[model samples]
Target chain A: MRIAVDCMGGDHGPSVTLPACQAFLTAHPDVELVLVGTADALAPAAAWPRCTLVTASEVVAMDDPVEVALRRKRDSSMRVAITQVKPDATGLTRADACVSAGNTGALMAVARYILKTFDGIDRPAIAAMLPNSTGGFTKVLDLGANVDCSAEHLLQFAIMGSALVAALDGKNAPTVGLLNIGEEDIKGSEVIKRAGELLRQAGAAGLINFQGNVEGNDIFKGTTDLVVCDGFVGNVALKTAEGLASMISGFIKAEFTRNAWTRIVALVALPVLNRFKGRVDYRRYGGATLLGLRGLVFKAHGSSDAFAFQNALQRAYDAARNRMLDQVRDRVVSALQAMPAAPDTARQAA
Target chain B: MRIAVDCMGGDHGPSVTLPACQAFLTAHPDVELVLVGTADALAPAAAWPRCTLVTASEVVAMDDPVEVALRRKRDSSMRVAITQVKPDATGLTRADACVSAGNTGALMAVARYILKTFDGIDRPAIAAMLPNSTGGFTKVLDLGANVDCSAEHLLQFAIMGSALVAALDGKNAPTVGLLNIGEEDIKGSEVIKRAGELLRQAGAAGLINFQGNVEGNDIFKGTTDLVVCDGFVGNVALKTAEGLASMISGFIKAEFTRNAWTRIVALVALPVLNRFKGRVDYRRYGGATLLGLRGLVFKAHGSSDAFAFQNALQRAYDAARNRMLDQVRDRVVSALQAMPAAPDTARQAA
Candidate 1:
């Protein structure tokens, strides 16, 4: 199996990416790593025979516009990294997965441009796998993809998300929840109300598991396996969770240092603190995937270190090995076809 | 200052409200408490000579609809507590401030009916006070009063929020920020975009200290004194913050009880934990005021205990002392008048 790595991506760039590639190769002797970036920038850090270097001089800045980065910066590391996955004359350039810890917009744009969106998909949704208290990870879709969405788009997201859960967590028809303000049947905006009806009808038809309505506060409550929403709400929810977690940790640290006795206690409980930190750490989960694309592409955090980058590679490897792309495509196609097209007016009247 | 307390509100009702009143009276010598509830309910609790019991027999259930609670339950304690502030024949029942920890929907309805919306104000926004990491608190308006909001309503909320912060926080002109997804020249939906322009124009005209923009994650960052948004986003952000805080506290408790060493450390760190809890607890800060009304009305959490209920009364007393209602009315009326009249050309442009 082969994976393309963007060595010039993320804050640390090759400093983290090169070491991550070496670490992954050490764990999997048969896996090949194709590092994409300028050769001189990576040569000092990467010293492995199994790793092949592909030079790309251009680099997309963290603040660059998504459209500009995708269309104008064709020679950038992210673009080159994804391009390596495209089938050549003999299909030798085809990679199992592509990993980049760069600007999220750049990564999504590059992926969509190179791999293209799947049939019946207008926009690709970014899905983040969060480890819940229920002993498995829950998939939250459209982390920051399409800001404006329709009920049909949300329904499509639900179908795609369920297939993703099946591919990643081995859950069949995972419970799908439409994120809203309340759990009541009459809650949420007009769009959400329509989405709920569609979800219920689809669920009744056995397309996906549609749990009624999940509120923003219940993201971590483990009520549903897949929480679906438009990009605007999803992005705010994701960022708010991140901010709150950081605030709480900061509060704990300040509390422990306010007094001498507590400081000593903090020293003794360092191991427990580390354990708790590890559980909530996003780096361990690697990166989010831009689902509904024809090929596997992952977006790691911009500030990811070697461990985080390596985790991204590993997650990408797993996605490739599990044939996630094929499963998503097949499930979505079949789900769309199996859907009874607007049950007769008489059935609706009933 | 005399504060009217709904002794029959909240989940614990007089059991919590009465003790809170007594505690406040014990701590604060100057303030007088007026308990509004049935005599039978107050009989079980302590009866102080300084505290006057106003007989209000009806009670609004936590799950009752807002219309029913306001219209049908005329003699409800929540209604009686608020009506005491309305202008009577001789204007004798007017309270300095009135507080209730009962159903929030009912409080909003009753407050609007009795206190009435300020001139040019369409609705009263629920401005919740949140704690910042540095010190004090930040004022956020329209928590969940009106879910679907227009640009004009949000502009009104911003004006009211700014005035409240200036009155309560002692800032001459507290900075007002439009709660948005990002801090770009042009971002967010059409409504937010229009609100941003309105705020900018309003700020330039010296009505408020309107800061450019604030993201959802910036609420706890203490970047601005007043953050304003429509009810939908505001509600989501508020609930998400509360949920995350609760989750973190729960996680910390679970972490400190894993084994013997952690338990020893927890014992040593109990004081620190208490201090941290104090900083995050909103009950100590008192209730959130319903701004843009002619009278001072505050809503406390329905599940509030004695301490929480007492804090609500204190909040009411503070609002009364500062004469926040009058200031809001005067500033809002002046600002609305100063705003450029509705443009026929602008409507055509949209």
Candidate 2:
């Protein structure tokens, strides 16, 4: 398996990406990496086993506009890396999957334009995995893809998310939850209400396991295996959780180091505290996949270190190995067909 | 000052509400409490001085529907408690403020119908106080009142939230942050985009101290004094934060009691950990105010203890004494007039 790495991406470019790729190559002996960035910057990483250095002149900055990244920087490392996954004229594949920790909007823009969205999937959804109370990950979608979504768009997210979970976790009928304010039928906006109806119909038709509406707390509770939401709500929920976890961790550290007496107590409590930190570590969140895309592309945290970035690469390798894209192709087709012809009209009439 | 206590509301009924009210009355020598519920249930609390027992035949169950609570349970403890604030034929008020922990939706429905919305405020907002990094509370409105909101509705929330913060905290200028997926101008939905424009214009006119767009993390970071979001988004964020805090606290407890060695360490660490827990205590959250209403009504957590419920009553008493409703009325009028006339259309044109 060959994974394309956008070396000139994230807060720390080649300095972080190079070491991550090297470690990933060492761990996964059968995997090769296509390191795409400036030649000189990626020189140190060339000595690593099975690493192919692909040169690109431009870099898509973290704060770059989507148009600038997508069109203006045609030779950007992000754009070039995405192109490596695109089938050539002779139909030969250079890389199985792509990885980037760059600007979310730019990465999405470049990937969508280059790989295009999968058939039946109107737009691609960004699905991130989070650790839950059940000691497993729950897949949540459209984290920051499309800010505004319609009922039909939510149905598409449900389909894509269920497929990803099923492919990766081997759950034939993964439970899909609609992220709403409440579990009651009358809760949420008109779009969510209509989406719930469509999801229910799809569940009855055996397209996806639609768990009724769930709230923000449900994501961490693992009430469902896959949670579906529009980008706006999902992004806020995801970032809010991150912020809170970071803040609490800081509080814990500050408490343990308050004074000499507390510092002695901290020495005894560090091990247990470290274990608790590991349990909720965001690094273990791995990568957020651009689900519903024609090709597999994973986005790591821009500030990720070597170990964190390696974890992201491992996720992409696993997804590629499991043929997640191929499985989603078949799943999306049937799920689209199973959906009600006019759920919006039906909900209104009811 | 007088406060109406819904004795039959919350998970604990009279057990929690009565004790809380008694404590509140004892703490505030000049304040009185009107305990509204069944006469038999209120018999014990009737012995307390300045505790007037107002009997109501109906008790609105926690799981009751909104319509049933609003119409069928007209004389419910929750409804009757709110009516104590309504000036009777003699034009005399029995209670200055009302507090209930019953079904949030039902309470909002009954309160809105009875008290009615303040002029220029299209809908009432639920404002809950959250503990920020600065050790001060940041008020966020529209917790779960209106699921679907227009751009104008968000602006109304901003105005109401700003007034509440100023009235309670005595801050002449409270910085308000508009919650979005990201801080960028290109992020969020059409409603949020237009709302941003209006908030900006209101800021220019000195109606509010708008700090532009902020993501969910900013809520905890104390980046702004107050955060304004629609009920749906605000409800989800609030619950998600609560859930995460509870889960983290549980994890800490579990880690400390894992083994004999850890348990021994826990004894030494207990003092510091307890202080940290108190810092993030949800009991400090107090009551969620039904903002933009003619009368002051606060909804305590359904599962609150005596101390928690008492804190909620304190908040209600403080609001009444400060004339929060009157302050909001004048503020809302000026704020609405200060807003740009055609922001929604202007956003679309842009």
Candidate 3:
């Protein structure tokens, strides 16, 4: 399997990605590693016989527009990385994946443009995997895909997220939920209200396990296997979740480090503390996947280090090996094809 | 000082309020507590001589409408307690403060109706005293009052929050920040953008200590004394914070109680943990006050226990004695009088 890694991505970049790639290669001797970026930009320590380098003169800064970067910056690392995955050129096995730890927008755009979307999917969504109290990962989609969304788009996301979770976690027809302000059916705005009805109809028909609305507070409660929402609210919820986790962890560390006695106590609690840390660690899940795409693309956090980068590459490899994209396509096609077309308003009223 | 405690509010109602009042009376020895609710409903609780019972026969449920409860439920505990604040037919202060552990909307309505808005203040925001790493409380306003907001309203909240922080923490000219998606000038929506400009003008002109825009992650950093935003975002942020605190604390307790070895570690960490718990304890700050009102009206959490209720009462008494409302009104009037009205074209441009 050939896994493409963007060497110019993330805060640590080559320093982190290089070591992660080397580590991954050492473990998976059969898997080939392709590092994309200018040789001058990469760390001296990264020069290895097993790792092949694809030179790209430029780098896409985190703030650059994804579409503009893809079109104008022909020699950019991100574009170069995606170019290698243009299914027609590589003859690379369908069992291959592309990973990037760069601007999420760039990664999403490149993936959508290069890999394309599935049969009935309007917009692709990113599903962030978070740990639940049940010791499993819950898939939350559209962390920040399209800022504005419609009911139909949300429904597509739900179906796609459910498929991803099923393919990844082996949870067939995983329970899907629409994230809203409240749990009641009549709780959200017009878009959510319509989406809730659609989900209910779909769930009743057994296409997906649509568990009603889940609120912000209930995200970590492990109530649903898959949660879907538009990018606006989803971004807010995701960032808020990240902020809260950091805040709590910071408070704990600060409190323990304040005095000598508390510091001692902190030391004593290390084993149990590590266990809890491992439970909430995002590194365990690696990176967020832009589902509904025709090819495998994984987006690692921009600030990720070597450990997280390696985990992201591994996740991408797993998705490729598991044929996640193909499975999603098949399931989505079946789901959409099974549904009846829009009925005439007059006839429906009658 | 006389504080009217809503004995028919909250889930526990009299069960929590009565004990809280009794405890406060025993501790203070001088403050008078007035219990507002049906005599039958409140009589079952253990009573204290310093507490006076004012019968309010009607009760408003948690899910009831704010305006309807305020108007139709005239004899409800919230309205009754708030009514005790006004000068009676005899023209004397019946109660110096009003306290309620009830539906937040109802409390806000009754408080606004009875106390009225302070001069130059359009809306009275709900201000929460949150725990900070500084071992003190940072005042946050508009926690969930108005979902849709404007720059002008956010400016008013900032002014009010600044004054409240000064009154509570003795931080004269407290720094106020506008919460946004990011810290950069171009990071937020139009509302936040306009608010940031206005606040910068206000700060530069010496009306407030406006600290510019702050991201969601910075709230717990204790960088600003007062954080202001629209009710919708603030409400979500507040709930998110509460949920996070509960989750972390629950996780800690669960881990510590898991086994005998962990139990020994818990014992070793008990002293430090208790201190940490005390620092983040919501009960200590009591209830949040409805700022920018003409008189003191505070709303305790609906699920608050006796300790929280008592702290709410104490907070109301302190605000009343300090004449916080009057101070806030004076400052707001001064600021408004001093601020130059933007030119007609500027208003249109805005």
Candidate 4:
């Protein structure tokens, strides 16, 4: 398998990317990496076996305007790495998948522009695997793709999410949760209510397993294998979870170091703390995938260290190797075909 | 000051409510509580010096529909308790404030029907005090009140939230963070972006301290004293935070009791763990207040025990004693009068 990497992206750029690639290559001897960036910076790491360099002159700054990254910097490493996944002359994909740690807006814009959206997907959604109490993960989307989504769009997200989870988790019929403010049938906005109905109908047809409305707490409870919501809500929930986890971790540390007796206790308590930390760490979950696209694209956190970035690469590799994209395409078609016909005269009338 | 208590609300109802009221009365030397519920159920608690009981025949079940609570159960304990704050004669407010540990929908419905909304406030927002890294708390609003809000309504939330923090946190010009998917000016949905502009204009006019756009993680970091968002996003973020905290706490306990060695460590680390737990405890921050109303009404967690319910009473007492309702009223008027006059040609051109 060949994977493309945006070597000039993220906080540490080549420094972190090169070392992580080397580790990844060592771990997966059968896999090769096409490192895309300024060749000079990445030349030192190209000596590794099965690793090749693809030069891209420009680098998308973390703070760059989306237009500048997409329009002005045509040769940006982020864009170049994504293009590597586009098929070559003989109809074979140049790179099976692509990974980037650049500005999310820029990366999404460039990828959407180059690879285009999937046939039935109105817009590609961002999916992140979140850790839950069940020791399993719940795949959530759109983490921050389109800010607003209609019921039809959310149905598309549900279908795409089910496909991705099924492919990754090896579950033939993963349950999908429609994230909402309340679990009641009468709760939520108009679009959310409509989305719930669509999911139910699709579930009844055996296209996907639709769990009824789920609240935010349900995400961490592992109530559903996949949770679907519009980008705005999903992104806020995802980030808020991160913030709280960090805050709690900080509180734990501060308490452990308060005094001599507490410091001594910290020594004995180190293992438990580490265990708790490991469970909530984002690095273990790796990068978020930009799903519902023609080609596979993964986004690493801009500040991810080598280990974290490597986890992202491994996740992307797993997605590509497991053919999540193919599953999504097939499932999207089936779900759409299975959708119940709409009521012809459903509008409120005299 | 006298506070009204809905003794028949919440998951535990009278069993938990009575004990909590007893604790609150014992802790405060001068404060009195008018416990509203079935006289048979609250008779034992009325023996205290200044404690009183007002009989109410009905109880609002946690699962009761809003209409049932508002229109059907007129003599329900929740409704009767809230009415204690209504002026009886000579335009004097009876009880300082009211609190309930009942169905949120039911409580809000009854409160709105009886207390009414503050002038110029389109709707009341649910404000919850969330623990932050700064050791203080951040007040977030519209947790699940108005599912879909106009930008104008969000601006109103910001104004009310600022007033809340100023009254409670005692900050002269508490910074208000407009929750969004991203921190950039151009990011987020159209409504969020418009809310940003409205907040900015309000800030420039000395109505608030707008800190621009903030992501979900900023909430825990306590980057701003208050964060305002539409109900949908706020509710998701709040619940997500709660779920994650509970999950983490669970993880900590499980890890500490994993084996003999871990158990020994847990014994040594008991103090640290207790301190950590206290810092993140939901009960410490109290309950969510129904803001933008003429009278203060707090909604305790449905399953709150005596400790949690008492915290709710204390928070409500603080709000009432500090005259939060009056402060919110004053701030809303000031903000409305300070709004910039619209340009004559600013409306969509013909």
Candidate 5:
């Protein structure tokens, strides 16, 4: 399997991605890496075995706008890497999947422009797994992909999310929960209420396993295999979790290093503290998949180190090997065909 | 200042509230307490100094629906306590403010029914202070009060939240941030975008210290003194934070108690760990204030213990003493007067 890597993306650029690529290639003997970056950035990977270097002239900055990445920088590394996944005139693709650790907005825009979404899907959604209390992870979708989603759009998210989870976790018919402020069916805004109805209908039709409504706390409680919400709410919840984790860890560090005596105690409890930190570390989760597109594309955190970026590469390889794109296409086709004849009327009635 | 206590509410009922009342009374000798509950529940508080016991026939269950609390349980302890803050025929209130640790929905419903909202404010909002890294609290509003809010409603929330911070924290010109998915002006849904425009207008008119747009992480970063959003988004963010905290603490405990060796280390590091826990404890932040109403009402967490309940009472006492209601009234009147004549048109343009 050939996977394209955006070597010049992320905050540290080559310093992080190069080492991650080396580690990933060592671990997977059957996988080949197509390193895309400027000549200076790709020089380190030139001698690597089973690696093909494809040089680009430009690099997308971490803070560059979508327009700059999409229109201005035609030969940017991120765009070049994504182009490797796009099929040519003969329907032959150079890489099975693509991975990038760059600006999220720019990456999404460039990916969508190069390899448009599937026929049944209107927009691609961002899906990521958050660690849950059951020693497992819960996959949440629409994480800032499309802020304003219709009921039909949410139903599509559920179907696509189910396929992605099934492909990655080998969990067929993963249970899906519609995220809301309350668990009751009557709660939330008009859009959420409508989405709940659509999800329940989809469940009845055996398109996806819909498990009624769930509150934000349920995301970490392992109440369902997947949680679906509008991108706006999902993004806020994700960022809020990130912020809280940072604050709690900061507080722990401050307390441990407050006094010389406390520092001694911290030294004694180093093993316990490291174990606790490992369990909640976001880097271990790897990357977020941009689902519903024609090809597989994973977005690593912009500030990812070598370890995190390697995990993203592994995630993309696993998804591609498991035929995630085929799974999504099949699910979307069947789900859309099974939808009601007058979905708009049904939403209005709801 | 006199504060009414609903002894029959919350998970522990009188067991928690009675002790909290006693502690509050001891802390403030000049403040009086009006204990409202069933006759049996108020028996312990009858002999307390500077306390008045008012008998109510019914009690609101923690799981009771809003309709039941608002209509069926007219004499519920939660209702009776809120009634103490309502004006009588002679325009004299029995208590300056009321505190309840009950079902949040029922508390808001009953409080709104008894006290009603101010003229310029369309709906009441739940405002609570979240601990920030700066060691100060960021006050967030519309936390599960109104699921759907208009641009004008968001403006009202900013005004009320500002007054609330000024009254409780003594920060006269606290900055207000409109919560959105992104910091950019063109980001987020239509409602959020319109709310941003209205907030900027309010800032220009000197009605509020609006700080443009802020993301969810800003709540903990202390980027602004106040964060305003629709109840749906705010509630999800708050609960998401709560869920994350629980998971992290649980992970820490599990790690410490995994085996004998870790347990020994935990024993030596007990003080540092305890200090870390205390820093993120939600109980220390006390209760959420029901803002934009004519009378003052605070809702503590339903599962609050005596310590948490005492903090809630202290918050209520402080707000009452500082004349929070008058401050909110003045701010709302001035803000509404400064608003554009065609708010709907302005929203359309946005």
Candidate 6:
């Protein structure tokens, strides 16, 4: 399997991605790396075996506007890396999947423009894993892809998310939960209510395992295998969790390092504290996948270090090996086929 | 000042509220308490000094629907407690404010029915204080009141939230942030974009200290004194934080109690751990204030204990003493006066 890497993306650019790629290659001897960047950026990786360098003239900065990244910097490394995964005239792709840590907006825009969405999927969604108390990760989708989604879009998200989880976690029928303010069916906005009805019908038809509505706390409770919502709500929830975790960590550090007596206590509790830290570490969960696209694409955090970025590459390689793209395509097609005409509005009158 | 208490509410009913009122009265010698509940429930507090017992036959259950709480349970302790804060025929209220630990939906419905919204305010919002890294609380509003809010409603939330922070935190001009998915003005949904324009205009006119847009993580970072969002997003964010915090705490406890060796470390680190816990304790933050109402009302968590309930009472007492209602009314009137006509659509062509 081959994975294309945008070596000149993210905060540290090649400094971070190159080391991550080298480490990833070392771990997975069966995978080849397609390093996309400027010649100067890709020079160090040239000596590495099983690596091919694809040079581009410009680099997409972390803060570049979507228009600039798309129209102006046409030869940027981020665009070239994503392009490698696009099918050629012969219906063959140069790379199985792509990984980048550049501007999220630009990446999603470029990916959708190049690869396009699969049939029965109007827009692609971003899915990420959140660590839960059940000693497993809860898959949440539409993290920030489509801010204003219709009920049909949410249904598509559920279908795509279910397939991704089944592909990666090997759960033949993963339980799906609709993210809402309350557990009741009549709890959310009009769009959410419509989405719930559509999801229930799809679940009844054996398209996906819909487990009713779930509150925000249920996400961390591991109440379901996958939690689906619009990109706006999902993005806010993900960021809120990140904020709380950060605050708690800060508070813990402040308490443990307050004085000499506390410092001694920290020494004795170092092992247990480290163990707790390892459990909640975001890096181990890998990167977010831009699902519903024709080809696989993983987005590493922009500020990710070597270890974190390597995990993202590993995630991309794993998805490719497990044929996640095929799983998504098949699942979406089957689910859409089983769905009623105008699912969002058909049951509204009832 | 006299504050009404709903004794026959929450999980423990009188077992929690009775003890909480006793403790509150002891702390505030000048303040009187109107304990509202069934006669049997109020018997224990009958002989208590500076306390009056108001009997109500019914109690609103935690799972009661809004319709049931509104139409069926008219003489409920929750209703009676809120009624105490409502003005009489001569425009004089029996109690300065009211506090209840009942069903949120029921409480909001009953409260709105008994005490209508203030002028220029379409709906009442639930506002809560979250402890931030700066050792201060970030006041967030509309925690599940109105799920579908227009840009004007968001603008109202900003005005009300700013007044709340000013009254409670003693900041004359508390900074307000529109809770959004991104910091950029071009991001978020149509409602958010229009809300941004209204907020900017309000900020320039000195109606509010609007600080542009803030992401979810900014709440804990204490980037602004107040963060305003629609009820749906706010509720989800609050609950998501709760979920993540609970998971982190569970992970910590599990790690420390893994074995006898680790247990000893927990023993030594107990002080530091407790200190950290105290900082993030929701109980210390008190209850959520129902803003944009004709009277003062606070909603404690349904599962609150004696300590938590007492904190809620203290919050009610503080708000009443500081005249938070008057501040909110004045701010809203001024903001609406300064806002452009059809603020949501006036500047769309611009």
Angstrom error of the Cα, residue A225, model 3: value is 2.1
lDDT of 4 by residue, A79-191 (tens): 98999898776767878999988888788888888988776677778899989999899899888877767787788888899889988989998989999988887788877
List, residue by residue over B1-350, the lDDT tens digit for candidate 4: 99999999999999999999888988998898889999898888866778778999999999998889888899999999999887765857668899899998888878888988876776788999898899989899888877767777888888899889988978879999999888878878777888788889888888988999898999999999999988888889999988898888888889999999899888888878998899998887759989988788999999899999999999999998788888998998887776533222111000
lDDT by residue (A53-119, candidate 1, tens digit) is 8889898887777777878888998898898777676756657789998888778877877878777
Best by DockQ: 5
Global Cα RMSD, each model: 4.9, 3.8, 5.8, 4.6, 3.3, 3.7
* Candidate 4, residue B155: lDDT: 84
- Residue pairs with backbone atoms closer than 3 Å in model 5 (clashes): none
- Tell me the TM-score for chain B of model 2: 0.95
The TM-scores of chain A alone, one per candidate, are 0.93, 0.96, 0.91, 0.95, 0.96, 0.96
Steric clash count of candidate 4: 1
**Number of clashes recorded per candidate:** 0, 0, 1, 1, 0, 0
**What DockQ does candidate 5 score?**
0.56
What would you estimate as the lDDT of candidate 6?
A: 0.90
Q: Which candidate comes out best when scored by lDDT?
A: 6
Worst 10 residues of 5 chain B by lDDT: B341-350
**B130-215 per-residue lDDT for model 2 (tens digits):** 87776677788778777777788888888889999988999878999999977876568887888898888888888989999998
- Report the Cα lDDT for residue B167, model 2: 86
Error of 3 at A134 (Å): 2.4
- Per-residue CA lDDT of model 3 for B24-57, tens digit only, reads 8888877888888988877754356767888888
Q: Which run of 10 residues does model 4 chain A get worst, by summed lDDT?
A: A341-350
Extract clashing residue pairs from model 6: none
Give per-residue lDDT, candidate 4, residue B199.
Answer: 87
lDDT of 1: 0.78
lDDT of 3 by residue, A126-197 (tens): 888876656566788877676446677788888888888878888887998887655667555566688899
Error of 3 at A231 (Å): 3.5
Off by over 4 Å in 3: A41-50, A63-72, A89-95, A109-123, A145-153, A185-208, A230-232, A254-264, A292-294, A330-350, B44-49, B65-68, B86-93, B110-124, B194-207, B331-350
Pick by TM-score: 2 or 6, better one = 6
Superposed Cα deviation of residue B106, candidate 1 (Å)? 2.7
Candidate 3 docking classification: acceptable
lDDT-better candidate, 5 vs 6: 6
